[model samples]
Target chain A: MSYALSTLWFERQRYLPAVLAVAFSCLLIALQCGLLLGLFSITSIPIDESSADIWVAHPDVPSVDLGIPIPEAWQSYLAVPEIAHTEPYIEGFAYWKKPTGGTELVLIIGARLGPDSIGAIRQLTPELRMLLSETSSAVIDEGEFTRLGIEKVGDTAEILGKRVRIVGTVSGLRSLAGPYLFCSLDTARKFLNPPPGQCTFILGKCHDKEDAPKVVERLKAHPRKLYPFTTQDFSFHSQMHWLTKTKAGIALGLAAALGLLVGAVVTSQTLYSATVASLKEYAVLRALGIPRWRMAMMVVSQAFWVGIAGIAFAIPTIFGIAFVGAEVGAKIMLPYWLLIFATSITLVMAMLSGLFALRSLRMVEPVTLLR
Target chain B: MRADGLPLTPSMKAWGLTRSYGSGDTKTYALRNVSLEIYPGQIALLMGPSGSGKSTLLAVLSGLLHPDAGTVLTLDKDLWAMNERQREAFRLEHFGFIFQGYNLFPALTAREQLEMILKWGTGCSARDATARTSDVLTMLGMSKKAHLRPMQLSGGEKQRVAIGRALIKQPNFVFADEPTAALDWKQGQHVIELLRAAAHDQGSTILVVAHDARIIPFVDRVLHLEDGILYEGEERPMELYGGPTAPSPGYIAQ
Candidate 1:
């Protein structure tokens, strides 16, 4: 065993605080970022739940939910060998007159209810699609009924003074800002009423999912100045828009920084005191003419080991907590890249703390060991 | 070669040495124009009262503390003339130190305690260090306890491990400051006997700083320090202690 590792093992009781502090920092950073990512993920639900491989939107569409009208004729722009099919998608926010005598803002999403359509969300079963085919019929998330001021799937509401009946409800499709009303294209047009022959976006399906980026690239040169994105790109763009608009990333950054600061301080102090406790033994080595760098290396090596140990403890706990969060309806996204990022930053913080603790080695004076 | 018919020569010679502490009205001298020579294959005991210049002299001679004036010429090099790095390198090559306390790392076993010196200081390979550490532990009668840490060993065993650390390099000079201060008389006597063997068997120059008068009979010569002044006591014959009879070296009168 290495001297540093042996020493750390023997004195693990003394170093526990540092290990725990590092673990806490890793946990806090990962969980907070995961929760924020999950929150922003909701903003891209329209793009994520669709079968479309590519989306063609207005030139300045920042997010799927915030899209502006584009001429439905632009669907022909996606006419390429890589594209298997195309359909017009209409979406806009409208105020619904609740039967309980109040008005609530709700997003109206309209798509072709055909089985071969690329714009309809996958949650719309054949029965629900057939029910939605009737004019002025809509489906919503079961959890949003309270927010929409409705009692059940058969309840009726008014959008723009036009009566609309809820056909059915789906699970796990809740929205962030407004309740989503999924309906047929004619029903949504009756409510949102974009200018004739215009839609919010034109979605395309590719023969091969990997060809979506190529198709999007080809559409980028269209004279109409269209915005084109693969489904994954569109999802990411939508989430990024909401993230920056809400300034939630800055809050996450501050929270993670605070965790790192606390971890650094505690870890630095722990290493400092441990080094000081061994000063006499180090002084003896110094008197025997061992170079100061050797001792410094040992301290830094201890810090490195502490970081590895802390990260080992944290990864499982992060996953476990994420699992619990999912069970309780709190979405926490622990993507592989996020895990790597959290651990990498945490390891760097620990190494910096090790450098900070090196100041204690200066107190080792060989002459003090005599007499 | 000397008038005493002894083939003696000094390996380390320090002259006109002076060291002081503090300054102004609070200034006090620890070594005042003191000089000494320690010969190879000889165990020289330096006895001094509290506040004497014993440890200061040891530090200066071992290249650990610098003297305010004068020079220490050891192994034919001016010890004080070398830069800090050079001095440290000089110590690593030729000097060994045993402070008053054991000062062994509590986490390492006895064998590891000695191997660390060769591995870290001399950069000796692991196999060589392990072999040398085994030999030293055997010599110290500590081979059986080589795997024990400081907490697991008795005080005397721990001190023996410390002594092994000092001798593991086979340094030309070994300077011990009150190595027996924390041991009982029997353990202290055993400690001095080990130092004697290093000087007599290994032909290393040994200088021990202690206040115990009981250690006088175990060493070949005794030197006393008082008020920063150094004094040489009468030397004894090597045959009396069954040690190798090296030529007698004369001391400079203080």
Candidate 2:
């Protein structure tokens, strides 16, 4: 065995606590970070699904959820030669009444009448589209059916205390804000009682996909009170908007931060104990003319091995939990960045723990071996 | 090259050394103004009743403990006068040690124990250390059991491995504190013979802190400690040790 590894092998059994701490830290950090990321991912879900090339919102809006309605006259934006068309959309929180007399929180998205464009309802069959054109017909996310106590399509559910029939199901769209309820503009206006020709903001498409950036740039400098962003930028801004502006966003972020802190503390403590337990052996190394820093490095190497094992154990576990989270509609998103981030944090924590644990090393007098 | 090509310097020397514990009336002397010299290429036994300062003298002469007063030198380099780091380096460079309990790392196999020592010695590479480890373990009769960790080794085997570690470095001095205290008379005699062989082969001096009389025959000189005082006593002739008489070992003059 190589020197560091050989030495670590001898001390391997004793470092279980440290390794376990790192594993648990990985789990905690990944879970919290995954939650925050999952939350952030969905924060932009509506914009991404809508597939609009550009979005116009009031300058003061922080997030998509909090944006003030831009004037409907902004429809003049479509006159720009590069502009394809525009769809006005609306979204708001709704009290989804269950058949059992319990109410669930849901966000509703109104796909204002236009092309098959500018809405999260990616594919609406002609029959479903014809059905959604009516004021009383809407599609519910299938994931929400369990919570609404409805078993199949054509079931009646209540929105805003009004009986509404679930005419279809929108697949593959979920929100950290819970399942979304989608409908036509007429239905949303009838249900939400908003003024005619006034919607939250205009969703604009470019004539060519490549024209989107130029349109966004030109529209940004356009003489309008409205703020213009590419749909991608708008989605990004919306996520950031909620992340910084709302209590839920802050809570999710705080939860992630708390996970990191707990992981660090627990891992550090375990590593420190492991180091102290090996002081006698380290002292022998010290006596053998190993410099203090080299001895410190021995502790680091031990922690590194433990950290490696912990990552091996943790990454799969996080992915598995994320997979399960998908089924339950609770977002646990472990992207590549989060995996790298959590692993880096855990390794650093283990190393710092080893360094902190070296405090007891000074007492390991080689002469003590004689005693 | 005489390991440096100089007139022989004493392996270790100490004069007017004093070390004690506690303070005021509680300050009991462990070694009181002890003066001593051990020379090259011989096993020198330190014998004394319990608490007669044998351990303290070993510690002081080996640079494990600092003396309150007086100078101690190993290989003509002043040990007590060096800074703490320098003294530690001096000890690592010049001495090998064995403790009463064997003091072997439980996780290390017998070969590793010796290799680790050799690796730490000045100018030794891993390859060279491994080679030296093989040689020394064989010399100490531990080659067959070199793969066994300390927990698997017998008490006598552990002691031999510790001896191997000390010998593998070819140090200027080997200090074995009660090296054979855990062994039977035959094993103890065998261990002493190994120490003697190392001295003869490497020209390194050996200082054994022990009370066993059976080991007396194998040593070149004997020092007795009493109430913190140390003094040289008569050496056993080679006949007494079942061999032809040989010249007595020389020492550096005080």
Candidate 3:
């Protein structure tokens, strides 16, 4: 074992605060970001819970729910052999005149009700699809009944003065900005009343899902001004739109930065005091002609080991807390990339803390040991 | 004469050394025009009362502290003439130190304390460091306790580990400042014997600073300092034996 590690292990009590501080930083960064990701993930539900491999929409379309109407004829633009199927999808926000006399905004998501449809969400089972086939029939989230001011399936509500009846309900498909109203493309066309022969988006399915990007890139080269994104990319793009537009990313970033600052302070101070405690011993080494950088390396390596130990302590705790949050109906998304990002930044903060702690080494003058 | 039938020369020579602290009215001298020579294969004890110039002179000679005035020539190089980096390199190559307290790191084992110097200072391979550490531990009579940390060892054993750390590199010069001050007479004697062996057996120059007069019989020569002045002797001057008057200038022990 390295001298630094041995010292850290032997004096673990002395270094525990720094370790816990680092763990706290990692935990805060990861959990805050995870919670935010989970919260914003609802914004991309239309893109995520669909069979489409690629979504081709108007250039101005910012998010799935806020898409602009594009010519349905754009389906011909994706007529490559890689694209096996294509269909028009419609989504827009409209006020639902609840029967109880209050208006709640609802996003109307419309797609083909076919068994092998590319644009319909996977949650629309054959039975729900048959129900949605009825004119002006819609599917609502079971959890959003209170928000929509309705009690159960088959409840009648009016959208833009047109009467609509909820045919079924699905679990866990709740929206962030507004509750989702799932229905057939014709029903969405009647409610939204876009220009005839135009649709909100044109979604396509590739023979092999991995070929979606290549197909999108090919469609991008065409003269038409359109936006094409693979399903995963579209989901991320929609989530990022909401994240930045709502400024939640900035809030979470500041919280994570504050966590890093706390970790740095505690870690730097801990290393500084530990070095001070060993000042006399280091003075002896300095007197023996050992280079000061060698001692600096020892302190920095100790910081590195402290970072590793803290990360080791944090990863499992993050998953545990996230699990608990999930059980309590609070979604906390801990993706692999977010975990890597949180850990890497926290480790860098630890190393920089080590650098900050090096100022204490200047006090190690061998002349003081003589007295 | 050396064992090889060659004449011996001073391994370290310093002349006209002076150092002080504070400035102007608060200025006080720690060393004044102190001069000395230490030869290889010799253990010299530097004895003085509190505030004498012993440690100051030791610091100056060891290239640890810059003297206000004077030059120390060791191994044919001016010790203070080199820049800070060069001087530090020189010290790494040739200097070893033992201070009043056993300054071993509390977490490292006795063997690690000694091996750290070899590995970090000399960048020696781990295999070679372990070998040298084993040999030094054996010489210090600390091989059995090499696995123990400072807290696990007795005071004398800890001091022995410090001694082992100093001698591990087989340095040309070993400067010890009250190495035995924390040990009983028996342990202190053993510490002195280790330094003596390092000098006589390994041909290293050893300079020890201490207050205990009992150490007189163990070293080859004795030097006394009083109020920034230095004096050399085969033994301590009689003035230090409770004589009435202080030893005059140029006083030498008979």
Candidate 4:
């Protein structure tokens, strides 16, 4: 065995407490962050999956929830040579009639279902296409279906005083702040029936993503006065608007930050205490001709192993939490990149703590071992 | 005095060594112009009163402490003039140490302790180090307790394990500070014989600092010290009992 491995093995018993502490802290941070990211994904599923490269709305459209109505003529104006296609989308809330004749409020989104449809609902699940193909068919997010106790396919529900059929269930398309229901444009317009020629927003897709900025600028200068945003800009605005304007988003973000800070502090303190407790052993090792850098390596290696163990423990714990949440009709989705990010953060925190704690080794004098 | 006059061949030499701790009026002298030569294949015992510099002299000779005003040459290389890293490497490669309490790592068994020393001090591979550790433990009569931790062994067994650890690398010299101070008469005698056999049979130089006096007869030469001054050769046998009869001065009977 190498010197580091031998030294670690020799002192494995002494280091176990510190390793467990760090691992537990990492698990807490990963689970907290994972839950928060999962919630954020649920909130933005519609916007993230939109086919439009740009969105045109009235000035200062509050959010997707509070979309402002614009002239349907704006769609034709936005369909310039630079733009590939443009379509109008409507968003509103409606009371859905349960199979038992009870009623529940849900957020409703309306879009074309053909090739030109933004296909936000279909992006959630391929099965949604079959549901949207029928004129009166509507797709309800799995969370909404469970919350309202609507089980069988082919069940009919009343949306905004209009009858609609529940043809399919889409996964991960629910909004925690509100239930989500998806239906085609014609059915939605018949239900909403705003004054003739008005829609919530006009969504435009460009031939190339690179052409998005130009299309947005051209639409912004249209004679009718509209606010245009590229898809990326619109997504950012929506996310920031929710984070800054809503209490739920702010509370979740703050809780996540606190979890990260607590994890870092707990891990760092545990490592420091372990180092102090083993100071004499470190002196003996130094006296035996182990280099300072090698001593530092021992601490860092211990931290690294602890971090790995914590992640190993955390993966299953997070999945369990998500599963439990799903059983109760809560929408929780863990993205792959979020887990990767959490692990990276955990490892970096561990390394930083190791570096800080190993500084104690430098103060050790070999002569102290003689005493 | 030099070892040239005697038939013994010297392995470590100290010339006019001096060391003091602290500074100004509070300065305390731990060693004062002390000089001694320890020869190969012999055990040298350092006897002294409390605060008489036996530990300081051992530290200087072993390169664990730098002498304030003198030279310590081990195997003909000046120890104090070397940098810290160089001195550490030199000590690891050439010196072995046995402290009073054995100082074995609590987490490791006796065999692991020996193997660690061999692996670190000699850069030996794991298999070779383990083999060497087993051989040394067997030679030291500690093979049965090889897997036991220090706490599991009796006082004498622990000391034997410590001896095995010290000799695992087969260094040229061994420096021990009061190896038997914590042992009873029987255990102390066994430890002394173990050190003697290690020096004679293994051709290694052994230097021990102690005031125990019980193990003095087994040593090849005795260097006595008083108030940081060294006196070569043995003192008058009566003078050995001049102070308190305990192992160390001020050490109350328990």
lDDT of each: 0.89, 0.74, 0.91, 0.73
How many backbone clashes can be found in candidate 1?
0
TM-score of each: 0.91, 0.79, 0.96, 0.71
Kindly report the docking quality category of candidate 1.
medium
Which prediction has the highest DockQ against the true structure?
3
Off by over 4 Å in 4: A1-20, A45-108, A113-183, A187-257, A369-371, B1-7, B236-254
- What DockQ does candidate 1 have relative to the true complex? 0.67
For each candidate, report its DockQ versus the true two-chain complex.
0.67, 0.28, 0.84, 0.22
Residues forming the 10-long window of minimal summed lDDT in candidate 3 chain B: B245-254
Task: Label model 2 with its docking quality class.
Answer: acceptable
What number of backbone clashes does candidate 4 have, counting pairs of residues 3 or more apart or in separate chains? 0
Count of clashes in candidate 3? 0
Tens-place lDDT digits, model 4, residues A15-98: 555555555555565566555555656556667788888888779686676676778887777767777778888877767777
Candidate 2: tens digits of C-alpha lDDT, residues A1-371: 74456655677676666566677788887887677667787777777777788888878877766556666788787568888778788776667788877887777678764454666455566667777887878887667788777888988878777888898887766666656777887777667766667777788877797888888787778777558888778887887766666666567556656755665566567666755666666665565555576666666776677788778878878888888888888787676877888899888877776666667667777666654
Q: Judged by lDDT, which candidate is best?
A: 3
Tens-place lDDT digits, model 3, residues A48-157: 99999999989988888899999999999888999999999998999999888899999999999999998888999999999999989999888998998889887899
Write the residue-wise lDDT of candidate 2 on B44-115 in tens digits. Answer: 888877887888888788777778988887667898778988877876777777777676666678887777
> Ten-residue segment with the worst summed lDDT in candidate 3 chain A?
A217-226
Highest-scoring model, TM-score: 3
The better-scoring model by lDDT among 3 and 4 is: 3
Better of 1 and 2 by lDDT: 1
Global lDDT for candidate 3?
0.91
